[model samples]
Target: MPLNSFKSKDNNAKPNRRDSHESTTRRVGVNPTLCRYGGDCRTKGCTFTHVNPPKDGTTKTSDCKYDVNCTRLGCHFNHPNGRLIDQKMVSLPDANQQNTASSRVVSQSPHLEKRAHQRHQQLSESELIEIIDQFLSKVEEFDTNDQESNNSDNEQVLDILEQNALQELRLQKFEFQSAINHLTAEYNSILSSTTDKKYNLLQLRRIKQKLERELKHWESRLPIYARRSDIIEKLEKNQVLILKADTGSGKSTQTVQYICDAHFIDEKQIICTQPRKLAARSLAARVAEEYGCEIGEEVS
Candidate 1:
């Protein structure tokens, strides 16, 4: 709401019987989004100009000045005298007498101004201490909130980076497992067939050697491959199995394959979830290859 809408004629004025445009009591402050000072504002009240000028052509340049007599505390447009300069106080010649520079009058006495300055300096030590304490408390609170906001932002960035890395690792694992399964199927076909036995046998030997080397290489690095039987048995007995492992532990891809091979050998309803799009596509393709079916037909 605009500040002028709630401005009272007098701070101590009583409420009228009829609905008045002015409000007697309403908590108010300058909106930061509209305030020009923003974070640099040091006053208790708004420092921006809010009034619009007349659209008529009669309005002069002098009429466009700020309302210096504004009574609101800490108002940036307040008059230098801290009060409106009454026209009556200024000296004026009579209608019969000519106005001259000698008849000019000063607005206020120098003694009154000096007295006001001394009054402000007469504050007690206790009052001074109380003011300092209040200022310090506000400063501490502002600093603490700023530090917390920065820490939260840093933590969020770290979490996103960790999730991306985990997704990439899972995709690579699926691709490697898919190649191994394809080579294994070719090796079995050669052993079971009789036509072109010599050529097929040589190719089968090479496939067997590649499969054995790949399996051994992974088994040495990943602990999950060696515990396949134990994991499968636990899954069979328990209603829900919680498999916890660090990133690149092979649990994401290998655990699903093990469960499908041991328990869901004939069941096409086995479902798996991946954290990212690429990981999901790769895992589905690899599982489909293992099952000897088109993608999304079984294990999608």
Candidate 2:
């Protein structure tokens, strides 16, 4: 066979031997000396078995490594102290032995019992009652102190809250006052504007009444006023008309005023033509004077 064949054969044969060893160990039980870590071993592939030692004083297969110095309880290993442990187990006290032990302990300490009895006898019933009363009084005093401290804490909290509330109220009052002042200023401005408007309206009414009186007086004196109704009727009946009158007969001025007062035209303005600018200006000034207005204002 070649070298590779031999190597493969060796590798295959190793698992068979390992498996046989594991089966044999399982049947015959593991040897404790072969496993250094005992039950605490963490090796997954370890060939040694792991188990706790028996604890009923049964026969063991091996001796403990630490011998008499081993501190493990209920260990299933042979040691020099094993016989002593067995003797102690056999010597454990029964119920009757426990009673005898207790009696022996009491008999050995007679001074302890006598001293306790003497102390009890020294304290009178009245003294015991006094001690209990004193304890109760101290407890009451401690409770009162705790209550007083709690009351003081509560009062402090209330005082802080009251101060905060007062501060908030003052802030609100200031805000309200500011709002009221602003409103008052606005009201005063509005009232002043309204009074001015009323005054202007009264002045305009007075001017209008004076202009009406002047217009009535001028109407009677002007020759064109005698034919006012006839002119208005003719103008209303026709979209175009031609009138002939004397130069100073108030033809230009009175005719325009009549048209304006009668509302013969739907538009707010009226256009009049004159042959000369001087005549137009003079008529405008006369009309302005009659209407109680400036030359450049309503008459213009």
Candidate 3:
């Protein structure tokens, strides 16, 4: 029975009864647009009651968007509902339950499970940057070597999981250093017994081929190469720096070896700047030969 249908004993006073009812009615305030269907609501058929919003923004209810499915105003997800404990996401049930007696039972959706899982995974800023740096560093290091061809002992790609992602950065650094050591050993094996410049050149080519894969990402972080002007110029142009002979004479045997001694910081890097692996390799071999032993043997 509706409240409006209540009957009174006085039959002749209908106009007075309605006026008395109107005087007792009160204006109520609610969430700006808290009108939503009571099907999913905590309360039924009453999103609000004659709600009036405060101007100074001191209102208790939200001024959110309309929740049209609601019995009152409707959905207002993006609304400013500070006091209202609203659901973050509203998903309709997958089952077609509108006409059935058990219309309340919604089908479970795989999409909802996936969304939950996705939200569970989150990476912090430090860990995120470290992962990026590690990847870029690997790209540089591998690009510098011929690991693609002489990969007798390549380390496994670290499993970067959400829980252990920080370990990946440290692990990759270790792996990077290990790879460099392997490459150095590979170079050593080729230079162990070669006296002839041709053999030296041949071995050097192999080394150069390996280094070519390392590419130009050498200083992706360190500024050592970037700060050196002469080295930078050579790296950019793929040119060799040649020191001319003195006075009007033909070049001495010592001129080449002298320069080879000056800039060849690491004997392995004698041709690091050379564009071609073969050229760098041959140069390394010749320098090693002129100095009295195979390259990389510490020719005294």
Candidate 4:
């Protein structure tokens, strides 16, 4: 019968262990197929077998197309059991087992055992102390490097803060300087304006003094101004005095001014009677011109 004849016609048929063993010939020391869940598989009807393979390599089996790397669930080729493969499907040895294996290998070889004994003697003396000192120095160097890096980062942060502070100070300084300049300009303008006002006042005082002198000179030329002291003395001695004077002799104008100057009475208190309104108006106009005042002020 052909090898292909052994293939089951029913796709869902349960696998027969006896037929599989007879057809492939049970390989001694070779493990059955590993279940997908390894030793942790709980399904009672699972098709793949889970078993530990012997470590002695005493079994012979046909190689798979993909060897240990095959991933197909229905593959019929041989693959390494979990114990002979990686730690994923099997528990790894602890530190004690590794040390026992190393010690065993060392004991099995005379050359390795002699070398290990020599190395042990060297470690009991100064060579082991030197190695410890070297490790300490390397650790200290790593710590120093980390500290220096932290210090550099702190310095950079401080520099950035200082720069920001300086910029703010500069901005404040500029604002203060601008305010001071504005106030200074205003003070200077007020001072110049006050100076101009003082100059104008001084010029007006000088002009007033000069005009007073000219006014006195023009009053000296008036005909009644010559007899001003005599008229004032006569009025002081008498309650009433009638003095006759020719027209245009300053009697209507200068007489009242002399009376007001001698008595120190307000100009509005004195009254003068005239025969014609035109003459009174003419006399008031002339008196105002001579008094250096407008018509309704000192004279009228």
* TM of each candidate vs. truth: 0.28, 0.29, 0.19, 0.27
Number of clashing residue pairs, candidate 1: 0
Model 3 alpha-carbon miss at residue 231, Å: 36
The window of 10 residues in a row where model 2 has the poorest summed lDDT is 2-11
lDDT of 3 at 71: 16
Error at 197, model 1, angstroms: 16
lDDT of 1 at 83: 33
Instruction: Residues 175-271, candidate 1: write the lDDT tens digits.
Output: 4466455665675566577778456644543453344434443433353555566687787788788888644456765677777645465754556
The per-model lDDT (C-alpha) reads: 0.45, 0.46, 0.36, 0.45
- TM-score for candidate 4, please give it: 0.27
TM-score of 1: 0.28
Give the lDDT of residue 110 in candidate 3.
Answer: 37
Highest-lDDT candidate? 2
Tens-digit lDDT track of model 4 for 194-288: 45654534333323322332234232333455455567788778878887864434577567766664554643377666786555655565454
State the RMSD for candidate 2: 57.1
- lDDT over C-alpha atoms for residue 247 of model 3: 22
Q: Flag regions of model 4 displaced more than 4 Å.
A: 1-220, 266-268, 298-300
How far does residue 10 in candidate 2 sit from its true spot (Å)?
99
